[model samples]
Target: MNTSIFSRFQTRSHGGITLRASAFAAILCAALHAHAAQDIYFNENTSVSSPNRYLNESSNWYTDAGRTQQFEGTLSSDYNGIINTESKISASCASELSLNSLTYNIAAAKDYNNYFASLADNASITLAEDFNVNITFTPETGWNIQTIRMFHNGRITVGGDFNLTFDKNGSGSNGFLEFVIRNDSASAALTNRFQVAGDFNYTAVESGSRLRFVTGIGQFFVGGAMDIGNILWTINNPSSSEGANISLGGLTGTSGMISLGTGMASTMTFTNSAQREAKTTIGYTGDETTLNVTMRASDAKNGYQILRISSGAYGATDANLGDVIIDTGRLDLGMHSGMKGNYLSIAGVDGVFSATASDSGNIGAATFENGEWYAGKIAIDIEGELAYDKIVFNGRFEKTGSDRDMGFEFAFDAYTMRELISAGRGEFILEDVITYETGSSMAGTVFEGNTSGIQWEAVFGDTSLSVSFTVPEPAAVAAVLGAISLAFAALRRGKRA
Candidate 1:
């Protein structure tokens, strides 16, 4: 048998000191080559038809038994060559992966654990062609990882399911699974494109877990349904401070929906500047869609505003683009900090619109600032046998001119108006009322014989009426009574004569 290079080095070390020094130099040279041989290279320009078996022992690839494999050169595959039996493959280089009219297919039903465990730092993947590819990873039992980051700058088309699982107790602080599609193309049309036709399921099983789908200057087009279960999915912009704008491309079907939480006490928050476009729309697919914010509690404190849209142009336009239809959720207007403006401002020339607060829900003070107060309508409907304190409209309740014919309808069972009078104020103006119906229990009721210092000025009519309340001075009431008594005594004397 031929003596190995390492064996020959050990044999010569027992000779003189000069031979021992030469033997050490030979061992150092062998170690350097072994380290350089660990990198696997694939050049598409040379032998494009050969199947580059990932586990071939005779090739330039290095494997740690059947556990892990690492590749270093630019990989351009045109067939099913990068297959994994029971090992995880990590392909990385200083530059990105160049896919040229090739399909980098991964074998199905194979459990390749921690596929990107040894990815080169700061290395990204680029797709040169708009071909189809499938990369699947089904982990075995008891496998946990911190994060898996995939940065692609090309048009990728997935042909199968893109399933990802973030195991419990696997991630710590600054640990998150993120997929970033950066725009590196000079052409505006082919900048950043990702289309997936299969089901995209991402599951996170830990607290403080976050899954982010970020895009630079391109759009994410999903041809199939996307289900993100129990992860705080943040859509971030690559350039500005605003959230990334996404187009759903009509992926939400009758049974498919883009759900955020797992029907629990979870939150999906959007943060940006105070502009209308900064507001995030849950169901902006331009179809009859439903955005479900499932709350497990019934208390108002427990049930927070599922959709908190805080911006200047929420209802600014007449087209009503991005009109959201929430399934079983509560809307909070002017709820965010430093957002104390109009709630709904609709231009009156389009058509008449109505804003209603019904079914035991509270609309807070100064909630409405109509563009034309007399043009639109406001309704406060109450059902069942319940009484409320008051519905305060703290802002202006007036018309454009002297025509006070604005529609204000109040339909309730039983309630009391809490003495709408200012102390020491003697006069109040009565505006036009469209409809007012006091129940039969309190019909024709006039509050009199009460020294509560309250006076009523009521104008009753067949169609419309207005009521005002004020406090009168004590001296004025006594002088009016004295004049009435003197007149009565003079009339008695004339009758006797």
Candidate 2:
């Protein structure tokens, strides 16, 4: 054969028979042409989302869910699939499947039902576009609350973003992302990951949305800002580096409340500023409905910060960390072994609001280990109020470090300081005597009681460093008291009846 002809002629073995490369290329093209881009619908679809669906079943799929347009091909990145079933437990074999998008679309004109979807073990899905959970309803019926319950024993990778936004003129909807791991060693693999390449923005989702981790080694990552509304994030995984983690790029935007609870040890980290300035309440991740809140050294294991400044995880500094409320839970900020649960890690706490009251002195709201909290480039504020009773603080509230100091302030109702001494605010816990590098100390006759608040200028006489406190009023105590009173009155009325 001539050199030119030989260059075009290559050998390939098919069924033990040699074939020219041109022939192999032609056959490959035909195979590739078989699966074309489509907006495919699962056969389980209905006007009112019902019936279950299978992701791996080919015969159960059709071109139209409402009509009999059977589709005879498997799903691919070139196709867009819809899961119109009320509940979807999709499983893929050992192979990887990538699609344009997946929607848990339960057709709605009636009251909303909680749609469910999860991946079985070893199953994986990659949405090349976005994973959207949407609901449509009439505005006159008010906000029709639609919810989607998410579960994962396997994996789901969203190429774009994941959102549960309202349809039909923004009626209303909420999505509950609960990680129902088997809590067994065989299930929670450290390598299991459920990631969103783009923002996991739930600004569209209404308040009271939840994302709880019962037990799972599946780590979740969000690539963009997490502008979610009010949310209560519960982390109940055991203490381990392999435990589940929810990572976010930034938590800016919404001023909605943020709450956290940790059972064993798990860390929820964010890369940049946590500057939403929302109210954060720390509570237990246990059964809040049936059991009462309890806090002890043993029950509170050593874990990292609830909203651990992931700047340190990525680079460093939650200088823009936001507001927090310790209303219904216990915060374990003690150092166990060499790692101090970064509850309010000094190295990253630009804003550590230690606000409290004296009513519920029963189960001290927050607990801290005996350690120092450094003020990065920003000042630190520890503000609290007082009643007739003492404000409770568990473990030890001691802190003093030679670390970087911007400044520290203890703005408290000093008049009630004497009453709180027995509960443990004996002295301004951050530091009794503000010592400067000049070997000089300042505190005493500044404001009132032991907590007169400290300033960089007052300590080192350096007026450059500024510190301020936005002392949140102690309404939590009154709120608790009112609720208690209401409950007692209701009981009395019932007994009379």
RMSD of each: 25.2, 20.8
State, as a TM-score between 0 and 1, how close model 2 is to the true structure. 0.47
lDDT of each: 0.32, 0.41
Question: Which portions of model 1 show Cα errors greater than 4 Å?
Answer: 1-162, 168-174, 185-191, 195-200, 221-234, 238-244, 248-306, 309-337, 340-497
lDDT of 1 at 423: 28
User: For candidate 2, which ten residues in a row score worst on lDDT?
Assistant: 289-298
**Model 1 alpha-carbon miss at residue 234, Å:** 4.2
Candidate 2 yields a Cα-based lDDT of: 0.41
User: Which number leads on lDDT?
Assistant: 2
- The worst-scoring run of ten residues by lDDT in candidate 1 lies at 270-279
Candidate 2: RMSD over Cα atoms?
Answer: 20.8
Error of 1 at 397 (Å): 14
Candidate 1 has an lDDT of 0.32
Summarize candidate 1's per-residue lDDT along 1-497 as a digit string, tens digits: 86655555545434354475577677799887654422222222112123332222224332342324544443443212232322233433333343333223333223322333212333433333333333333342232222222233434444444455443243255344444344432323223445554455555556544455434434454433454333323333333322223422122111111222111111222111111111232322222222212211122222223223332322121111121111111223212222222223221221122222221143321132222232322333323223211222223322342123323334333222223334224444343322223321212322222123445543433322344545557786787678889999999999999
**All candidates: TM-score:** 0.31, 0.47
